[model samples]
Target chain A: MRDIYAPRIHGIDTSEIRKVFDLAAKIQNPLNLSIGQPDFPVPAAVKEAMIQALTDNKTGYTPTAGLVQLREAISTYLKPKIGFETEPDNVIVSTGVASILFLLFQTLVAKDDAVLLLDPYFLIYPALVKYHEAQQYTIPESFDEADVNSLNDRLKKDGKKLKLIIFASPSNPTGKILSETQLRLLSNLADEHDAVIASDEIYEAFDYEKRHVSMAKLSPHRTLTLNGFSKSHAMTGLRVGYLAAPPAYAGIVQKMVTLQQYTMVCSPHAMQWGAITALKTGIDAELSVMRKRRDLVYGILSKVTKLPYPDGAFYVYPDVPIDSADFVTRAIERRLLLVPGYIFSANRNSIRISYATREDILEEGAGIFCDMVRELG
Target chain B: MRDIYAPRIHGIDTSEIRKVFDLAAKIQNPLNLSIGQPDFPVPAAVKEAMIQALTDNKTGYTPTAGLVQLREAISTYLKPKIGFETEPDNVIVSTGVASILFLLFQTLVAKDDAVLLLDPYFLIYPALVKYHEAQQYTIPESFDEADVNSLNDRLKKDGKKLKLIIFASPSNPTGKILSETQLRLLSNLADEHDAVIASDEIYEAFDYEKRHVSMAKLSPHRTLTLNGFSKSHAMTGLRVGYLAAPPAYAGIVQKMVTLQQYTMVCSPHAMQWGAITALKTGIDAELSVMRKRRDLVYGILSKVTKLPYPDGAFYVYPDVPIDSADFVTRAIERRLLLVPGYIFSANRNSIRISYATREDILEEGAGIFCDMVRELG
Candidate 1:
């Protein structure tokens, strides 16, 4: 029989990082820094909440928009923390923020519509946009800051066909945050162009330079802010995330969520309860630990001859003296694994290293990476 | 501002059945039979597996296809039970069978393609097909045995445009199981028309009269078998279900799953561990309990003044002597709750009564139901 696989799906290869992690798993390596998950245990309180929910028989399906209490909690949390005054009606709890983005892309973009990506972006974003039969337009990030004028120029050039603009701040790989002025400029341009902005704030809690500013707070009219517990609370496996939107777009997203209702009902009910606890009790200690780890990795990486200082997330994007793919291959040969930056975009000389590891592992991995660079030099 | 809600979402008007349930909830009714969830704790071994996984911090994302061990267990379990020589590659663990159905629709059905559904069917099936922009061609069940020749004639007439056909056996609402001959005939028709057959056997263990046969076993070339622990082991809240298909189609489904990976990375890692335990240990005792409940309710429901005895799932579909909506409302007035058949399809004279409650509650609910039927008569 002819291959039944959809053409769009063929383009999404498994994550390069996951491939490395698989290798690490096979070798039974202790203290590997290959994958993006946090090293901390899920909070005792969060786990306790899940156990309690399970015992309470809270396993039946919740409303597709999610539990009213959780959405309300998210609304409350976002307003004070991110300056976005969202109502419960404007929030939909999803299986994860990943699902929210998938739904948003499905609802907003049709075949042939273009979604602009801030290049060196999340690996999944391009694959997701492509799955909708939508085109992806990547605008390389200006290392100094997000350049709003250039972005506006691109939006103006695209005319009416640009459906969405996706960016993460404290971005994955790059770890760059769009300043408030830059966000205002992009938001204003999006408004003028009549395009939606999907701001992925999954890494918002891990930012170091300044408090994260949500695009929704700056432009509530056109932004859908995506956040979740996976990153902030070390609950990646629990798979709970949500989308907060303006009331105008809420119905569209809700319709998409209703479709999701048939697929994965509400996020696992116990996980929803766990997420409620995570949001209600802040992740201060968790953030402090990640920050400390981030600082340690950044300090070591910055001392390397040609690497740039790290910014945010658990990653460092170092400019390798050789092709990134080759650099990564060489590093792995010496028992170190780092994601090549070319997988995120087209750059060939940069590698992305995740600091989501124990300090000792980070120290060992960084030493190996430094030795590799010196050998290559 | 202009309503920014996407054009696709149509808000659900509160149905008469929902109104009845709302009133029942307010009154705190004891013999409630409204929703479809089974009233049983998840098996002890399953719970133990989950607790052990949690304690061990087996809380990271599993492979997108689900944990290898769980898929292998499902493969081993289904091989003999369903008469299919399945391999691990043939199975993909999903958040629930609901998700498997959703992914199948998205992957196979394109805009305006017709998918054949059996009515009165599961309520979510049509909605999910609609979400995919596919046309739902529901052939109403005969209440007598399904006429394979008539179904074949319809498929012959539609031919190439019919992309898929879905049926549950023993079916939901009606609970009628297709005989082996009927399944073979349907499989022949699906093969002739090149249409995919999705066999939802989530309630396979609830079959009381005879062994259940999977359509995939009859036509492995053109069928996908869906099953899960929710109904069988009362793990509804745990939300793990799976689909097993021929290698060619399983690949397509897996790709579609990859696209929605952001929604759920895998079934909860811990849930997969629990499900493996559920499958390994077996659900024989649980099946016996459900069969006993089915026998009790079937007997009680058959004695009602004017109701039909239907065959599968935990539900007994009986014709209400009064307007089904009115009968349900009246039942709620006396503190009973049953799903009116209109929600499943356009069956206005029947209601679906679940036999998933405890025996004492089932006895009381059935007595009240029969009393109401006789009073209305």
Candidate 2:
């Protein structure tokens, strides 16, 4: 029975997030902050558009790359924004940035190819690279200006095998936005090394201090941009995302679309219709609300533990005095849900707290977190 | 830049269906029968259910395996019907049977492992196998009892390497359903060889003459049954499907779910709500409509080319005297669209006609097909 699976199955578990979900599920009124999705309801207008689509019977399969007009809509939005020499043919619609990233990695990485991830990377990047039988190498350090120079030195030594670099801005655990200079450094390295940059800009709408600069905007020829409506509009269940590549890599884009066509066909047709509205209606109010939450978390958690002030997304990664798994377990015992930093980074001295919930929950969760840290001291 | 892609991508192209889609896009009032989706709208109740789900704020991602009650709904429907010793834990909801198949193959098939497909298989099967770097060995002939014996004898010599077999009943191009005896023979061969079975039952409700028998029922210990709401419920655009495996292979199921969690997360949440209604509502009316169209097609085109009287699904594969590509081209010149047989099989002298459209359109398409054949004669 064990032999019934590919060897990869034995190595792959259900994801460490499952551990947190299982723990959170068992607790009564747990002050949970583990998951990275916005807890807000989808925008009313977007929901209305989807309902209208269903009413109009837009349930037939769209072209595999997605509806041409939706692709056009995406390119129109991104061209002036992301600085791509872009068009509809350069974008492929997908169920999420998840599926787009999966296809992108599989399309680019061969066996033994080295894919570079920024340290404290998204939890799933290594999993994807491992499944493709590729090697995963994180950058020498985080992408501060000094760290970027260190990364360039490492690349100078072993750059030829570098196939892809996937780093999210306003990232998952740290919520740190890459500065424009940082983006330029990575873009230059990717261009010099012939590596592709997968700028996972899923959190583009939540930037607090500066406008988000797409890695593709910094280096269009060597970057593939991944973004979606999931976070910006609280449409995670809708499963709408797109990968925008440059025309110079149309053949690779075609291959990714072909893989998606034979796998998922297209994203759910009705959702694609809803996404048209989602992109049009901005999320300024929601962003402001989240900005306050981030501020509140930074304000309170800073009293308890050392942490960098997060500039984007909705999470704060703070250093914990105890082992992260032990810290999470103790938090669970107190009816609090938190993710260990190791889930995002190789470092294990910190924990990630998402501030995507209501102000009251965020306040309570941060209060409990502070009390726990004081107790640890 | 094309050289930047993995070599596996070089061998892949857009699906053969795309050629039909592209050609049909240009034709005005074309009698198109090249692709295999129903022209019917999604059932009203199901559409309303999805709309209501969106209204109810079911736009957040479900658990990776899908909504628990949805998986329970699928298992409850199949338990008495397919005879699987299964539970909700045994299922993973996917965007469609296409994604399910892709994951199943990647989960089960190792590189160079021999996979057995019935000849004239669905076009996507080989593409999926090749993507996994697997070797595809076809059953000696087709899935008649005679062919089963031929396959058994063939496997007797190479049984150790026979990893999996994928066959669709009430199949896409030919619309042929496997007899019980044929299924039993396949079950015996798979058991003797330790090979897994992927039963693609996407067209289960389309069977008109005999009750559909699932391969999982005959080989529950060694089968993965794939089914979905896309076909019978006419929700192709909604993109909902599931794979049900035996408890003995829980690890495989878990692996599949993990792969999905990291890739697509889950199917669209609103569609899952629609799928619950889709499963409960019967497809008797749609079946009868398609049955009548099948009858209309056989009456007209049986005179023009050699074809089995298709008993299920919406398509009939008819042998043509001239080369299929050439025949399809000539038909296209007259604004008629058909898929050449070479797209499905090594055989190149036939074409596939789908009767999934309105009866009037089916009649016109069949009439045009017959007239073209008569002209050839």
Candidate 3:
């Protein structure tokens, strides 16, 4: 057959995270810290709502934008949490935050348009951008401080070429949460650059030190806020997320949703029901448990030299004494799994350790990881 | 803000189907026949399986490709249906055939790559191909006969520039099923021209006259068969579709799925469970009910002078006696709604009426449509 695969898509390598997952899947071990999914079951209220939806026969195609009630619930939920006032018309329920991000990339990034992505960002961003034939410009995060000057300089210089800026607050690999001031500056810069900021707040509920702030709250006109029930309510498998944007962009995004109609008609009806319940009844208790787990894992990991203070998203980015890849490989050999920082656009010397496990598993896994570090040293 | 949205994306027009949908939504008292969703509920077995999955807490991200058991089930099911012996690894459960089609377009159609689309095609095909920066080459269908010679000549003239060919068997909008001889000729032409064929068989189960034949069964190496439960089991809201391809191209498609991880992580676990049950237990009863509705609507539509024969996919594309747009507008004026064929492609003087509604609704809607056609004549 003729080589029909698109040139831009052929270059995406197999996910490095999946490689670790494959290794973990092979082992017969009981505990798994390798997966990005929350270990907790979906909240009972959410599950019950889904069950109720099924019993009600709410199993037909929803409007391509999504169920109005679910969208309204998301809009209402975001008001107090993110300090943004959004209407049902502004919210589009997606399969997950992943799908929203994909739409954001497709909607904002053109064949030659450049998208600015923070290094040590979620690994999927570059791949999605490249899939749209857009150029991905990685701006390394200055860990020295949550500095906005470097980013501003880059945005000011390459602003015209840049179409979108995507970053996860309480980011993957690095649990770096952008402060309110830093976010404001970034939002201002994005507005100045005429670039849309796609703030991924999927980890909003899992922040330990402080409440997460959404860039959308600061600049609603130029921001697409993406979050879901995946991490917050432990409904990753449910595939429910929402995209909130200014009404000006809703028409365009809804058109993209029309295309998505061919892909996913709408978020699963039962899942949308679950999300409605999740938004109506909050995830405070769930957040508390995740916070406690975050603290427990951080307490154990701090003993290791050069471990940055873990902030959020059930992960700690620690500087490994050895190469991060080697440390991860050896940890896997010891039957413990952690994502290498290299997967998140970082150097190979730092590893990401997820803290979403139970206390006992956290203790055992952290001990193994520390011991492995010492042995390698 | 200097329009952060991509110019290329903004340049593409909003879906014409959605415009018709908006008009339908605006009508105060319309006998709606415009939507493509199955009016039936998902099979009892499917719903029960989903309920069981919810109770069982089968709510976590499946393998990026999809659930192993589901893929295995799909493999087993496809062997006899497609005549292609495939392993589980060759199948990827998608959000729907729409997503798979988008993935295939993104993977194969780079900028300037020409994709041949059968005209009177699924409306989304051209938009999606255009979004990927590919040129769409329309091969107007020969309504009365399968004209392989002309098709081969056109394909041969384009040769390497022709990256892909997309056609729906038991076709959408038209509902005409491609005969086995036509399938063989097209597949052979694709192979000879070194082009990929994407056979959308989402409507296969609704075939009335003959058992459906998968293009993959005829041309295993060059064809990608797209199917899902949305139509077959009335699970449009559930969003589960599968792509069956040969092992060689599976890797490329898998990579695209990996990139799509953010948009939809995996099809909903609950829906996947439901789909497994739907596929295992045949949909003969559901098909019978749908056929009855189809027949009722067809019998009514047949009375309209210029309307064509109803074929497959719960839809009847009939040439309207008046301007197709005017016919639909007049119908709407009289509280009846049907999709104008101009939305499917330009200059087609027809309307697509979905016959998936209940007997009473179908009868009422079809009566209104026939009255409008008679008045126009």
In the range B317-368, model 3's lDDT, one tens digit per residue, is 8777777778777887877778888877665688898877777777998887
Compute the DockQ of candidate 2. Answer: 0.73
Residue-level lDDT for A236 in candidate 3? 83
Clash count (model 3, backbone only): 7
Better of 1 and 3 by lDDT: 3
lDDT of 2: 0.84
Candidate 2 has what TM-score? 0.97
Off by over 4 Å in 2: A152-159, B140-146, B156-160
Query: Cα lDDT of all candidates, in order?
Result: 0.75, 0.84, 0.77
Q: What is model 3's DockQ versus the real complex?
A: 0.65
Worst 10 residues of 2 chain A by lDDT: A140-149
Predicted candidate 3 versus true structure: per-residue lDDT over A44-67, tens digit per residue: 888999988988889887877789
For candidate 2, list the clashing residue pairs, or say none.
none
Which one is best on TM-score? 2
Q: Is the docking of candidate 2 incorrect, acceptable, medium or high quality?
A: medium
* Candidate 1 runs further than 4 Å off: A2-13, A19-31, A143-146, A280-286, A305-309, A374-377, B1-31, B140-146, B159-162, B248-250, B281-289, B304-309, B321-335, B359-377
